[model samples]
Target: MTAKVSYLISKPVVTINKGTHSIDAAKKMAEHNIGSLIIMDNEKLIGIITERDIIRALGKGISLDLPVEEIGTTKNLITINENDSIYKAAELMAKNNIRHLIVTNNDGKLVGIISIRDLIRESHVLKALSVTSEQEWIGSD
Candidate 1:
């Protein structure tokens, strides 16, 4: 059985306003033990800032005091519905070279986020189940 994106998204999605400082955002991420934050603007999902974005901004000499919007990925915000298969999410991530994906409800509202780590965990679970099933079959007369 294929797992859905809903199975991977963490609850009560962590979000930050677009005007939030990069340093502050990083602090929030650390406090929450998360890698990314959904960027909001006027009660709308505008973009996302991830650890990778922060690293890139620092490497480029961008000021951490600047708003996260200035360094965040705004264009082409990749998203998938909550019911979409995890395989599809994996494909989207691989194609976009992104470690995270925003999940939206049917009404097009931000619901949650999924990370590559979540996908890897799900893959491991599936693989273990497959191995167990195969072993059972082999052992059966």
Candidate 2:
């Protein structure tokens, strides 16, 4: 069976609104022990804020007091359908040179996200299952 990217999407996506301060976004990430947050405006998906984004902002001497919408990587955001295969998610990530992907439903509504880590973990699980099946088949011979 082909595993779907939806399987890796976590609910409620940990969002931050458009005008939130950059510092607050960093704090939210810290509080959630997560590396990223979905940026929203009036409940609409706008962009994404990640640990790297904050680190880059700070390194560039950007003020934390600025709105997260300004600091976030809002332009050219890459997204994927939640029902796509995990392999497709990984391929998209690779093609876009991104570590995270905003996941949407068939109606183009934000539902969740997929990350490189999720893909890695799923791949490991699939590899384990494949190895187990191979062992079983050999043992039956």
lDDT by residue (1-141, candidate 2, tens digit) is: 778888997656899999999999999999988888999988789999988889999999999999988888889889888888787787788787888889999988889987788888886446755776899999998
The predictions' CA RMSDs to the true structure, in order, are: 5.6, 5.8
lDDT of each: 0.89, 0.86
* TM-scores of all candidate predictions against the true structure: 0.85, 0.84
Candidate 1 TM-score over all chains jointly: 0.85
- In angstroms, the error of model 1 at 10 is 2.9
Clashing pairs in 1: none
- lDDT per residue, candidate 1, 1-141, as tens digits? 667889997557899998899999999999999999999997899999999999998999989998988888888889999998887887799799999999999999998998988888886446755776799999996
Give me the runs in candidate 2 sitting further than 4 Å from their true place. Answer: 124-141
Give the poorly placed runs of model 1, Cα more than 4 Å off.
124-141
Query: RMSD, model 1, all Cα superposed?
Result: 5.6
Name the lDDT of candidate 2.
Answer: 0.86
